[model samples]
Target: MRPQKIEEQEMLNGFAKLFKEKGYEGTSLAELAVVTGLKKASLYHRFPKGKEEMAKAVLLSINEWVEKHVFNTLTNPSLSPEERLKNGLQSIQKLYDDGNTPCLLQAFSVQSGIEVFHQLINDSMSDWVDAFTNIGLAFDLSQSAAKEKATQVLIAIQGSLIVSRGFNNPNIFINSLTNIEAMYTQE
Candidate 1:
């Protein structure tokens, strides 16, 4: 019955930041409490199922964001395909903090986290591929070509993110996005 101290979105953002920095197994209740400015008991009060529940909430929050900003923008009929691609990439850049932040999906792919989140991860990835495939279709690519292009785009983003982080360079990530735009927008 106590009033909430932190707002829901702010709390989730804190949880997400820690989860992104450290995988589920590496993240701890103490660390989560410190990041969120919430006591351990308060977090337990909010997420009775504990770390798993908190991780699920964070993933769900991220999924909702992508659905709205990325998928919705890509599929909006009012915008031209090039415009949609530009907007979608902007959203993605924001999502990753221009490669300074690691991917939430990759963070959760460690053995312990993946076992619990495999289906959720798989389904979310499929949704990403499907969204990009729609964009490829808009550019007049055949169905098979569109799907192949979509998969390549996903691979390129993931690979570039890894290499960018490894090399301590955001330009690699930015250049990859530029290449992706050219791949689709070029005649």
Candidate 2:
């Protein structure tokens, strides 16, 4: 794969952070330009499709991040299931600590032109589900049960992020993790 130019990667990272802080409708091209240290024309030059293009880029970047960090941690061969869950929760905690930003998938889902963004979201989410399901299977769960648990974990995570941000408390995510661990233990 060809490496992205530093400027292009910088702009995409800035867009990802901003879009996480502010939903698609709330982010303006001018704000993106300011955050990226690029003129509006320059941003448009890099992303001809404008804000939508930037939003797509931001979502893709974060999806890749989640796959690498969170999902990979859960599936790491060196970590036991309990350790994997702990490491995964720690990864999430770091994300919250870094910036109490909203979930990009949920943020984009509610936007006006989100239909254009669904494919990326769906693919990323499916991959996440698969990751968790594989972990569950490794722990001796049946395939169906594993996938169901994965869905539950995903839903709990999404809800935890929304509620945690809404309540201005990061513990909601930790609490959700506890509940999920309990569920797994009961199985």
Candidate 3:
């Protein structure tokens, strides 16, 4: 991984936070420029395609972070399935507690108002589902069962994020996880 210049990293992080909080449609180029402490012209100099380019860059940054942090931890060979799931849930909860923001991917999908953004959203979601399915398979779930469970877990997570955001309660996410666990144990 190449090290980003501090200014570039700051821009990416600012965009990620803004995108998470405001969604794609709600955030404007001027607002993004202000958040990054750059003039609109300077922002454009760094991201020539303008807001769309910045959005894509923000998504890519978040995607890479998720893969390196959450996905990698969930798929670590030394962890048990329960341990992995718990850690994943905890990581998500921490994100909510820190910012009270919705999932960046979901926010972008709902607010981008562009067909290509929809395709990008689908691709990102598929990657997440595939990762969850791989983790389930490591726990001896059959392929179909793993996929199904992975889908359920993803749904639960997204739902929990919505609920947590609305209610301002991070524990709602843990409660949702309890429900997911119950589904797994129930005959």
Candidate 4:
């Protein structure tokens, strides 16, 4: 019940960064403690189920972030489809730190991590597709076309992230976003 040294979001960010770098199987309690500036006891106090629980919390936090920043922007009734796409892509850029950060979803999809967090990962990805599909609908694409474009958009994003990191070029990611915009906006 006492005040903690680290704020909750800060603590989760610490955990998320480590997980994104190392994956759930690779991260350890000691490393998490060091990253978060918390003792093992404090971490346990917050996550009684231990590392798996922490990973689940990190995944949930990421889903919430995507929902708010990406999904909401794309679906906002107040914005034009163009405006929504622009803002949503901006949020995506920030989410990945302009391609400097690896995706937590990718990091957590390694064999062991997938085994434990499959449902959460699957649902997050489906939600992403649904959001993009909705945006495509706003652009007057048919439902099937919108869904196809949505799948392609997700592929572009995930593939570009890997290529950008591999080539040490953030522009790959930036260009992918541009291409995605064109996909929906261009005839």
Candidate 5:
């Protein structure tokens, strides 16, 4: 049998998707209640601190995913830097749904949980950048140069997602990944 926390995490994952789409300010307790199949009282019981707490939980889970599945791709010892970065880019692709999805961090950046949201976003992004930097280091790039490349990769991924979403075009997003790969191979 699954533990209760597993069930809770499953519910939280559901909430994460809703919050990703609607954001902290836009998503309501009523919506959460409906989506989670719980009453307001039940939600309060599970998440005693209310909506802020729920958003924190969701963001933390996302951070954990970044730490686990995403970063691990960069750290995998068997893969070359190119392969690791390519895998990481694929993870980024899936995370943003080929640019069709909204960023959960962008969603949480507004509304009631701004402080926690921003801090978690910073922590999560720093880890992502760090992973990219590590991949560059594997290719003997200097720390500063690697950091810059990492930032560029992140910017490309995020910017592509935003633009592609705005224009309803995923090809730009795909091309952005290709460009990053070529950039890496060129370096």
Candidate 6:
């Protein structure tokens, strides 16, 4: 890739991490400029709509990544349930740093709020649940059972993320994945 494109992607990754750490309303243009090593005017030159545009780009990038990695890993029929679940867990774990980091969906949905990004957040989560549900179904779980298991898995993951972040413990998150994998094999 071109040097300019690489720099642009580096900026986007920086913005995404900042938003993950600080959320939309909590993040500031000055901070973004600092993070990206660009002046405020240059940031404006890159994203004409300013912080909102930058955040939207980050969110869109996140969705694309999740679709390709997490969602596709879960729903890939060519992979066994064991393989699918393992790959999905691995991808998601990396995304959140094994639960040390907050999920972009939760961070962006926090109190201050960005109404425009709400649909993106919701769709991403729904896609997760649907992917997990599909995995459950592949394991021979009843439709209702599969949906229930999917919900449980999501709850376990998000809850573990909270615990891991709060107590500075990533094992809680890792153990949650272990339990989720058990959903298929131990049955």
Task: Tell me the number of clashing residue pairs for each predicted model.
Answer: 0, 0, 0, 0, 0, 0
Relative to the unseen true structure, what is the C-alpha lDDT of residue 124 in candidate 6, on a scale of 0 to 100? 76
Residue 75 lDDT (model 3): 84
Candidate 4 lDDT by residue in tens digits, 149-187: 999999999999999999999999999999999987786
Tally clashes: model 1: 0
Candidate 1 residue lDDT tens string, 61-177 = 999999999999999999999999999999999999988888888888765635669988899999999999999999999999999999999998898998998899988998999
lDDT by residue (tens digit), candidate 5, 52-92: 89988988888888778789998899988888888988887
Clashing pairs in 2: none
Would you estimate the TM-scores of all the predictions? 0.96, 0.87, 0.86, 0.96, 0.90, 0.92
For model 4 the TM-score comes to 0.96
Model 6 has an lDDT value of 0.85
Error of 1 at 22 (Å): 1.2
lDDT of 6 at 105: 78
Show pairs that collide, candidate 5.
none
Q: RMSDs, each prediction?
A: 1.1, 3.2, 3.3, 1.1, 2.4, 2.1
Scored by lDDT, model 1 comes in at: 0.91
Candidate 1's error at 16, in angstroms? 1.0
Mind giving the per-residue lDDT tens digits that candidate 3 earns over 1-187? 6543447868988898888888988998889988877788888778888888999988888778777777887788788877776676566556555436678877887856778788878887888788888777876789999899989888988988888878888678778867765555442
- Give me the runs in candidate 1 sitting further than 4 Å from their true place: none
- Model 5 per-residue lDDT at 97: 76
**Which is better, 1 or 5, measured by lDDT?**
1
lDDT of model 5, residue 12: 86
Worst 10 residues of 6 by lDDT: 1-10
How far residue 85's Cα lies from its native spot in candidate 6, in Å, is 1.2
What's the lDDT for residue 41 in model 5?
A: 82
